[model samples]
Target: MDLELRHLKIIRAIAEAGSLTKAASVLGLAQPALSAQLKRVERMLGGRLFERGRHGVRPTPLGELVLHRTRVVLPAVTELQEEAVRFAHAFAGAPRFRLGGTHGPLLGGLVDRLATAHPGVPVTTYTSWSEREVAQGVGEGRLDFALIGTCGESPPPATDRLTWREVGTDPVFVMLAHDHPLAARRQISLADLAHASWTDVPGDGCFADCFAAACARAGFTPASVYETDTASCVHLVQVGRAVGLCRATFPPTPGLVTRPLAGAPLSWRHLIGWHPGAPSAGLATTVLGHAREAHAEAVARNTDYAAWLVGHPGFGPAHPAAV
Candidate 1:
């Protein structure tokens, strides 16, 4: 028979009891029946798992190795089952929204729409720079939904544990001080900023690597990239210390202008994810619809981005089928 968790438990039981007769008693099987099962298991494993001594039985070399691994695997399997149960059960509680997000504008809008969609149910949020952390929270049942993004066509984090639906796409843009030479231009070419210092909020995704690849394609190495928090990145750009790469829908700032990159060298895809087996699974479509609505609002609210999209037809919220 194919090895299974039950088989692992049986092996552990026999190893602990030291003999088939006693193990059979502990496992509620006749001694001969237990012996037969062990033979079959040993045949499948291609080695004897036990050796009879004068008083009892002892593990063979192969048995010792299998037991060592069984010790680690059984506990991990038990923990996984427990977590899966919790993940499914967490959605049954008081109607509430628990959202985790990376730094972005759509999260607040999603919070707004979800609050309105499920009124009286409390709404809570957890923010992390690590997209993996946010996705992990959703998988572990710590959050009901996750609002996260990936660079270009990259897959959303934790595809194995959560279901993801794309809400929108936006061309990555450059943020420059109002008086900076390139700020007045409608669009800035990546090559034009080749010599400029760059700054962006640190993140755990492939965004920085993607940016480096884009810069490589533009035929120049970036002067330097300052990895810091959002406020620091913005401040570096505000004082003309560096230019910040940001979303097209980045809010207008008094001292900065956000401009699209020429030819759309980099893009961000917004995604919403939930554990498919959780109680929140039933609301995935609703959450996705609301996420789209929030993205639309962001596009409308950013006048500079709105006008820029007028000429760039295919660069805004993604089509349903395209996701």
Candidate 2:
């Protein structure tokens, strides 16, 4: 027996998620089928790939070896598929568009707009957490387009084949509990809360790094009294412990309110990235048109929402404060 794409995919999925059930869920396979396939791969490799445990399966040393190889092989396979697709489209004169986004409300909104506005084009939407993943998708031809938040500090690395452009900017906001003392104020600067304890998003890249960098630029390291990956960082403020920095477009959660960080120079920008060899005609334009419209709509909505919220009792004053 020889290792195949399906086996590689299963191995990679198991390694990433750390459990057969989760791998199965991601791969859309039945538990029994995935287990059997895993066993088959292990038998072919002549080693026990995974060790069954009380919590879940753990990759044995041998499993790690297979997974490492699979990671490399899988990307190559994806590239080959893209190459074949390019040739096929060239012959048929039909264009295919693949779009990627960083995960969150922005991705959802962009996808919604694309589906609604350009119903004729076949669109494949993809998302990942790390900038490396997004960069890889564009560089490897896995994605023709990417909507991402790229700060000036960490520009997407020099991929000779990809191009990036700034489409929109979302100002940073300080999210707090509705009843908090500063929540009732019209606008507050980074200086206003220099002495207050802060809560930070736990990750090291993307939005979390942006928040930390922004504070550092303000000339004071925010005293990180708490750091968590939970969705309800504002609730930490509601309990009177810590406050958090977030983008204005972050989805509104219960008991949390976000306001512009007065005098803070930092704001998250939405960037549109695409491959240099991307589709130039037909479906590509239709897809990009939707992406552009979606971005414009988000920009307009943010502006309108800022204007509407100014006078809406308990949010801010009756006039929109300059951001």
> For model 1, where is the 10-residue window of minimal lDDT?
82-91
* Global lDDT scores for all candidate models: 0.88, 0.66
Point out where model 1 deviates above 4 Å: 1-92, 320-323
Residues 77-127 of candidate 1 have per-residue lDDT tens digits of 855874776666664667777889998889999999988878897889999
Point out the worst 10-residue segment of candidate 2 by lDDT: 314-323
What is the TM-score of candidate 2? 0.59
lDDT of 2 by residue, 196-264 (tens): 787745432565566666667777777765765546466686676777766666655667677777654
Q: What is the lDDT of residue 317 in candidate 2?
A: 15
- After superposition, the stretches of candidate 2 with alpha carbons farther than 4 Å from their true spots are 1-96, 120-122, 195-219, 225-241, 280-288, 300-305, 308-323
